[model samples]
Target: MDGRPSFLIGGGQAADAIARIDWAATPLGPIGQWPQSLKTALSMMLLSSFPKAIAWGRELTTFHNDAFAPILGDKPQALGRPFSEVWVEVWPEIQPMVEKAFAGEATFIENFKLTIDRHGYPEEAYFTFCYSPIRAENGEVGGMMDTVMETTETVLAQRQLAVTNAELSHRMRNALAMVGAIATMSLRHATGLDEARRQLSQRLAALGRTQSFLSGEAAEDAHIYELIEQSFSAHPNLRQRIDVVGADFRLGSNQALALSLALNELITNSIKYGALSKPEGRIGIRWDCAGFRFVWREAGISGVEAPSREGFGSKVLMQFVPASFSGQARMRYESDGLIYELEAPAAAIDNT
Candidate 1:
């Protein structure tokens, strides 16, 4: 026999590397002098397809199989180095666990987070692993065995899912609050079933339009012109009478949603009672991109008046929509026509 331990034979690339290494230069001394216990443990470790490594004796020298290569990523050669040196970057975090293993305690951890410099830059990573004590011929704890698998991808996916679920829950709660408020208002003042139904429909339509962009199907930010275009798409006849003039640009998600809903409420009011209700009715929409101001004007109509009692639409225009954009809104009930204006800090208008 060549006298080489059988574990050093036929381990594929890792085995070839082991045979070429000079054990005399290391703390483990020469290959002929290795303990039988270590040789047997290594033989079993090399035969398995699992990613594992052994850190042996006072030097904690490292020995690993071909299956352990991916765990090392682009790390320097680690075959015969001290275990702590091989993972020096994370030594502080893992030192306790290593100590525990050598102290005859078996430690198992799942999705343990770490920051490593594997690919030339530091990045977050996670792993699931076990560190077990390896016994010596005298029945004393002599070394440690590390059996590990990367779990960075699975951990990140779970975090993303948790964030998505939280956002969905928050939105549902806000929507339910708005619906309950509207229902209370309608029931308190509703004169008849038809009137109550109409009020709820108008407000719900505005809310529905708000959700179209917030539902993740649409871009997070939308242009001013797109919001106006979508709000009036169903009213082809009124759409022709309206003139929109603005230096169009994208608005942040919150601003876009508020503007879209407010525009819908305005369009509904004009159709039912303002200029759009008359054949000679005309409407003008303009935005001051520099000053962050918007105006809706109705002309060629007479005797337009505000509702006697403030309803859900009133609350949306005067309170909710303006508050959403950190702005103020004004509605004029004049004999000539109805005019509405909203203004806010230019910096606050389109955050994106």
Candidate 2:
């Protein structure tokens, strides 16, 4: 009765709009008049244009905006009905969340998955939402406000990436098997223990090279010319004694290391027990490829037999070569000298 005409003033207009006035049929009368400022602010906030809604009476009422109606198709019709009555099917799953929110506790969930049957079509969705307690005039928890966002696409994409990585690993292992087979066939006929051991060591070195390459490792390849140059560098007098005649072939990182070691062992053995040990002896190293197969031979060992039992050098040479490159080593003894032979798949020997 102050006759201030609260509705006529700017602040009074807001209070009047915020005041509760039931839209659905209810047992209680219209909510007592509220200040105009409070009413105006609340009227705008509850304009039914958002996707989330406020629930009163323990989520029994839908203070929903138009934005939330489509997602809850028929629920809007039961505005003042008990939540359990309207969404009884989902009650068990949603009950705990509602209880926590109503008990004045804030709860948050992320990427929460759920399946909803919409118009007979089941749709899966991921949701992130928070339930916050809403307070009443007496400062007591009255209901809850729900805010949510959808994130279905991002979750599915990550699952797909995991599957792709597994497939890649399988293919890589299969390709390695093929390479191993070629290395074994390459050194199948080395004429003597010394010759066979040298070829075997090379193949093993090649295998090590492949492993390194797979892990993105790199190093210089061993060139036949370079090996010869290094060998002769140690003995300027022997430089003319050894004959290396062949077109230099480029080797892949894998081939380079293994072949280099094999050549090194051969040279060392020749110096100690082969033709190089005799001032009048000569050594010849040569190679040729036919179709998909490569052959390499080392001749001139002063017609002497290398040890049969093998030493550390022999073990390393034999085990590494064929095993590394998937090839084989062969040894033969001739009245003339020793012959070490190597034969392998073209693919394994091809530098390209």
Task: Point to the candidate with the largest lDDT.
Answer: 1
What candidate 1 gets wrong by more than 4 Å, as runs, is 1-12, 29-33, 218-223, 233-242, 249-254, 278-282, 299-310, 333-337, 350-352
* lDDT (C-alpha) at residue 186 in model 2: 39
The digit string of per-residue lDDT tens for model 2 on 74-113 reads: 4335445565655565668777998898888998999888
Stretches of candidate 2 off by over 4 Å are 1-24, 27-50, 73-81, 168-352
Best by TM-score: 1
lDDT of 2: 0.55
Cα-based TM-score, every candidate:
0.84, 0.40
List lDDT for all candidates, in order. 0.83, 0.55
